[model samples]
Target: MRLSICAVAATLFTSTIAAPTSKFDSLANTSEESESEIVRRDGGDGKYFHEPGGDNTLGHYDKRYFHGVVSDEERRDTQKHMVRAYLDFFRKNDLDTWIAHGTLLGWWWNGQRLPWDFDLDTQVSGATLHHLGEAYNQTNHSYTSDDEQVKRTYLLDVNPWIWQRERGDGMNIIDARWIDVRNGLFIDITGLSETHPDSQPGIWSCKNYHRYRTDELYPMRETMFEGVIAKVPYSYDKILTDEYKESALVNTQFNGHEWNPNAKIWEKTEETLRQEEEERKKKEEEEKKKTVEQAQMA
Candidate 1:
């Protein structure tokens, strides 16, 4: 079912961590919260219902949320907070993590975000995810922006499902998310499980997801991404190629932006690069002709 942006936004905003109390209240207030409604709808039976929102009534299918029309300014602001939360988690736990997939593609060329990207993707080991779930569930992080008035609070969403890997469903390893509730932008954290057949020591086993050795992914590299401290995989090229073919590195058009074979965005940057190359070639030819004339005189 399709969820509307407003409904999704409302659900996310209200699903905050419950205030801690020394004693559990047997009769916890059960006022029908937006999040609970959303959860019920998602987990509900086949019967669909309509929800009232002013003159228009939104249906169950209409409420499913995907990528919405987020402004560029809003995206940039949201990305900054998401990156900060990721870095904070890594630093606190000493876990090695790096940007992957489309996020890495953005970092590769511009050292910035893909203006059209809806979310961020990062990779961690199975062990790392396990560590985070146990130690960092529902942690709060705060970052002060360059402007003193803009203080952002972020929540760490480490799903408890990371430890349930015995079922053989590989895709379930996606373990955590650093969600920006205000903007609906999130960072998806996936665990790269070890895959091996014999269960031998130093041999990893990944039943559903792709397998890689610790040595292959170790020695994380430091890189600047979206104007923040970021980590990248050691063999980033291999990872990219495995996920997306070599063409993806060169393909410019994706999401909303047009892929320019010659330029970065296909609109302006390619033209600039082409002009620069043409000018360089013309200068080289002129220099060559001058050298030939000088040689003939000698």
Candidate 2:
């Protein structure tokens, strides 16, 4: 009887499985579109996407899939789940990946994302990037909450321009993204490649123009990030210091928030709140002035 039940369960699971869609196969053509065309064609609303004059190489941000911005408390809750799911998926697939940039800095401070941050950053080797683009791009992964009350789907979208690897045209720096289809939040995944394998074998570079020596990255260390096991560069301290400068490691006050050692969270400073209130009022006044001018012109 037990064997019969096991067979039935396995059959049921197999019956319910469905194939993934190739939603991102056409992304290759958009590789060189002007900034305006990119947002229009990609369904990005410009809220979280790259600005016209801003860094164009950053990964694509899709507003159509976004669930709109929520309060800070709610945003953090969603992010916590997003990151854990991301790490688990990569590990189970046996793909080599590690945290990078601000995400790495967050792991250094609290083994998680910084409270103020809205996205995550991760990286893969050149081989891994190609494999993912070919096999997993445009795939959707479904995850259910612990209580089974909420289910969110994530999309792994690969950049078609992964082949143009020479930091060319300063666009498409980010190689791919693991995106939360429900909220538009995502982890930017870049690929690291040999800058000059023939001459500078030890040197590597990302499309973003950041360069690193092998000793700074190799032999990745295992660590906890956002409550899941994750990998980080070996010389994390030096990497952070090199990118953000030494003061970033020691500074307690930043971006109108202060670190609370006991609570292990960044709290909004009183001054920051006051400044925000003033800014809100100023914006209101400016809007009112614009309304009056428009009325007079009409």
Candidate 3:
């Protein structure tokens, strides 16, 4: 009797979220209230359903909610929403979080989302995870944006497999996620815990098998991400260089892109890059033909 009632409720819930003509209409037409239906459609919390054992990978989410391929604008909105919602929650609860990985790299160049990046990363302490588990796990956060006049729902879901410290499976590395319930956009959160492996006495490790020094992450620096103030590693320079490379910090042209200081973003039209490549190839071909002709005449 209870299952039937829940099923009927879920059906009704999904009906209400049908995408509207508005620009801000959710790319994925459902929210957390209808999550049970989503789970039922797929055996697990869906993310990367194509990859074997992807259901187990922490932070790699499936975009099954999207009816078709996601648009760039939708990707941009999803990223902004993910960060804005996350920062709001942390600020409200007095929880400390630091931007890490690609998200931090993006902040270094400009206070904008990296055009090609969708996955976001953040970190907190082990104690913080437990605190969240006890008080806020499986919690749904609803936020209202006056500008867009849209209410968005987010979910904080933690992985119970984190208790097993062995770090054997690649599938279960993500400690938790702050998920955009409507679109499946999420910020992957990992808890750094103190570990005493044979190599060192005081080493901080995460379930993902990453080890760091105790002092490395401490004294988090205040910085802005996606236009909002947030925390970053104290030794950002060192961390960024280690993860990416020294040239990555200085290179303006990457992936056929150039920085536009006025816009404060990477901007290069596909046609422009294509033309440049073609011109270069044409010049190379001319030089090669001239060299061969000269050699044969000699």
For each candidate, the alpha-carbon lDDT, in order, equals 0.55, 0.70, 0.64
Global CA lDDT of candidate 3, please? 0.64
Tens digit of lDDT per residue, candidate 2, span 1-298? 0121232223221111111112322233444546575456445643223322223222223555644455667668878888888888888987778899988887777676877776789987777787797889889998776678767889898876676566666656778888887767678899887746677766767878788877677677666777777887767789999898888777889878998877666789999889989988999999999999999999
For model 3, where is the 10-residue window of minimal lDDT?
Answer: 13-22
The number of residue pairs in model 1 that clash at the backbone is 18
Model 1 — which ten-residue stretch has the worst lDDT? Answer: 19-28
- Error at 8, model 3, angstroms: 50
Better of 2 and 3 by lDDT: 2
**lDDT by residue for model 3 over 221-247, one digit each (tens)?**
565566565777656768788788888
Clashes per model (N, Cα, C within 3 A): 18, 0, 4
For model 1, what is the alpha-carbon lDDT of residue 22? 15
- Misplaced by over 4 Å in model 2 are 1-61, 147-150, 275-298
Ranking by TM-score: 2, 3, 1
- Estimate, for each residue in 52-98, the C-alpha lDDT of model 1 and write its tens digit: 22221121011222244455577767786667666765866666667
On TM-score, the leading prediction is: 2
